[model samples]
Target: MLESLYIENFAIINQIQIDFHSGMTVLTGETGAGKSIIIDAIGQLLGQRTQPNFVKENRDYAYIEGVFTSNEKINTLLDEMHIPSDTQLIVSKKITKDGKSSIKINYRSTTQMLLKTVMSNLVDIHSQFETHQLFKQSYHLQVLDDYCGKKLSILKEKYFNNFNQYKKLEKEYKQLKNEELSDEQYDFYLSQKNEIDELHLDDFDEEEFIKERNELNNFEKNAKHISQYKNIMDSSKGMMSLFKDGLNELASIDSSKIQDLHDQLYDAYYSIEGINDDIYDYLQLSNFSEERYNEVQDTYFKLNKLKRKYGASIENILDFRAELDKKIQYFENRESVISTLESKLKTNQENAFKIALDISKLRQENALILENEVKEILKDLYLPQVDFKFQFEKTNLTENGMDSVCIVVSTNVGQVAKPLQKIASGGELSRIMLAIKTACQHNENNTIIFDEADTGVSGKVAESIGKIMKEISKNQQVICITHLAQVACFANHHLQISKQLKSNDTNVKITILSDEDSIIELAKMISGKEITEQSIAHAKQLKKNNV
Candidate 1:
């Protein structure tokens, strides 16, 4: 339920706060009292789209905030917002002159659409303009469904699930069974995969192999210029013998000083010996030949060929091979897949039919009850012979289910109840709309805001509509914007919208009336601009009688 609303700088509303409760809180005022402006503000706070022109002249910004209390479902939504419910949810909207609107729920930044969805469950603003989806031609089916309640809803859910499941298998079956793959593309992929698989290459460190191959190439080029250092040193008795001779000569000069000189020379000789052994070993291992070079070159060329046909690297080529294998296997079992999917699709269709049949049956039952209830409501409104019925059309299986339902009505006695869309009179439309609301108000949770639903109605009919709105208030909040004093007279919580010329501007305002204020206002509505004593007395008598 909506607890309260605070509006500021919102089109002549400068600032107004209204505390709301669980019954019908009616707004009654003279023409152009800015009642619609109040409704519009509430709409904004509830996440309804707003027009820029709604901002008051010279005002930089407009703000509206709504406070709501929720149930279990609303609590779950609060969890998504990451905010504690704390028994109250506040939604606020600020529209600036720059055409920017900032939306917030419980002070958390939010989008208008999100806040609107949340608020929808909490408050339903039924406007004065007979703009209800139920009244509109396009919304006939939805109204029937709502009246059917959970009976139809559950069946519809089951039907839709089956329908969707069938669609899934049907789509896959179509893709696999109906597609014609190109022969060239298939052969290309198959050859690529087979070629990569045939490589039989060792999973050695490729980086290391390349390094070794480069080293081999270098050794092959420099082999002739290299010499066996140890063989030369031994055969010619070159540096080794000379170094030994120098060490002995140093030893003879001074025993201690010569010993140090010999030790240094000995160390140099040992280092030279190690270097010679390494050079000899490397030369021995070089086995480089033109034939081996050809082998390496051919392997590089083969790998490159695979890369162009498949991918840039060995790892990527391997992945592509895996994909091709899966696709080919799918084609191999294409018949089996189609067979399985066809069975599933058939089974799903059967399930959907059963569910949709169940839903249709329940709607048929509920439709009878709803029609009777509407007839009763209409009887009270002085149309005892009104013909009303719920009409159903069967459509192809849809997510919303197989039943296409609508509300049908005929104002005159013995007339066939055609679809509500075909009825043209405003009075009949208004009455039938109220009749439907009266029938299903028990299931709806949001506040019922009716703006001039009583238009083109008067006398006992007007009085009955007021009584019906008042009755609706017992279960849900009812806000009726009305031109008729009779309807306004029945409001338990009456608010009035009136306008005045101020500072060369027309300003509108709303006021929630006390009983005394209501009577005077009702009299003004009853008697027009000139309120005579007799009309005021009549207004007084009407209130007295209702009380």
Candidate 2:
């Protein structure tokens, strides 16, 4: 239940704090007294979208916050969402002049989605416009499911999971069956595989082979140059012999001076002799084989062809081959795989149907109870001859199940019930929504606000609507914004909203009325601006009778 609400700089409501309690509380005011402003502020706390105009004129920002008493369900949800809190939940909203808004749950900043999730367990605001939701068939199923409680919910969870698995397997089976290859295609793939497998090219590195082939191109020219150098050094009067003769002559001329020169000449002669021997060895080793060259060329070309067919690199080509192997294997065992998947799908289908059947039974039983209760409530709302029923039809499997629910109604006796959309007026729809809310008993121990729920009814019917709201308050908090005195007189707590002209500015004020003040407010509602003795007496009598 909501403990209190504090709003500042919101529209004409400059600053106000309203204390809420567990029972029916009604906010009654004249037209243009800013009653809906309070409802809008509460809606923002529930994470509804806000506009820039929501802030009061000349104010930079607007602030609204609600303090709610928490329960175990709310605490558990907050813990799961990592939101910090104590025994109370504080939901606040700030709207700036720039049309940007921020929401906070327990002073921890949160997104609108999270705030909505939290508030859903805390309050339900049934604005006047939401009565249209009663005409939707899907909404009917949802309401029915809520009324059925955890039994249907558990079965629905299992059914949806099984349905998802069945869909996945069906998709896989169809894709594999579509990919079955013909005999000719299989033979073509086999031939390509053989061509690549026969090469044995994995043992060879193409880069290294290219390097050796290029080196072979330089072999002949290199050998010719080495032969010329060797012939020069090995001649009798060549460099080696000349060096040897010089060393001997220099040694004989001067023993000490020529010893260093003789050592240098000896080193030069041996270096030239070593070069000649190495060149000769290299020339002998340069014998090239045409057969090996042809073999290397063939293997390199075959590998390049395979690379072009598959990918640019050896690793990519190998991965492609693995994929091909999977495809071939799948087609080879196509019938067996399909049969297996079909069996699994059948089992899943059976399981889904069995669970759906159980869920349907629960819904059918609950629908009858709900329908009778709604009819009883509607009877008190001055809809005495109204016929109400829950119509269920078989539909294809959906996330919910194989049932589609529609609320059927008939306004007159002896008439067949039809879908509410075809029969219910705005007033009837509002009463129906109230009936459902009262019957379902969803969201217990939380605030349920009706923003002008008594829009299109008057007289005793309006009083009856107020009585139903009061009864609903036995289990939850009810806050109603209404204009009818018949409804406002029945509130356990009465709040009167009034507008005043203060210093050339329009201001709104809310006062929690005492019994005497409540009677005066009701009299004003009964007689408009002119409150007379008769209206006051009538208002007092209305309150007295309800008490």
Winner by lDDT: 2
Q: Please give the distance, in angstroms, between residue 228's alpha carbon in candidate 1 and its true position after superposition.
A: 36
Judge candidate 2 against the unseen true structure and give its global Cα lDDT, from 0 to 1: 0.85
Question: What tens-digit string does per-residue lDDT give for candidate 2 at 1-547?
Answer: 9999999999887899999988999998888899999999999998899899999999999999999998888899899989986899999999998889988889999999998888887888887788888867889998899899888878888889988887777776778768768998877777766776676545657678878766655664576787787778768887778777877787787666578877787787788678778778987776766677667667678878999998797777777776666566666787776788789988987888888888889999999999899999988999989988889899877678789888899999898999988888888888888888888776678899999988889999999998998888888999999999899887999998889898888888989999999999999999998999999999999999874
Tens-digit lDDT track of model 1 for 235-352: 5577777777877777677677768778887898889878877876777775677787776667667878877977898787777877677557556676675677788888888898
When superposed on Cα atoms, how far off is each prediction in RMSD?
10.7, 12.6
lDDT of 1: 0.76
For model 1, name the residue pairs that clash.
26-493, 26-495, 27-495, 28-495, 28-496, 29-496, 33-497, 33-498, 126-449, 128-451
* Sliding window of 10 residues with minimal summed lDDT for model 1: 126-135
Clashing pairs in 2: none
Give residue 252's lDDT in candidate 1 (0 to 100): 78
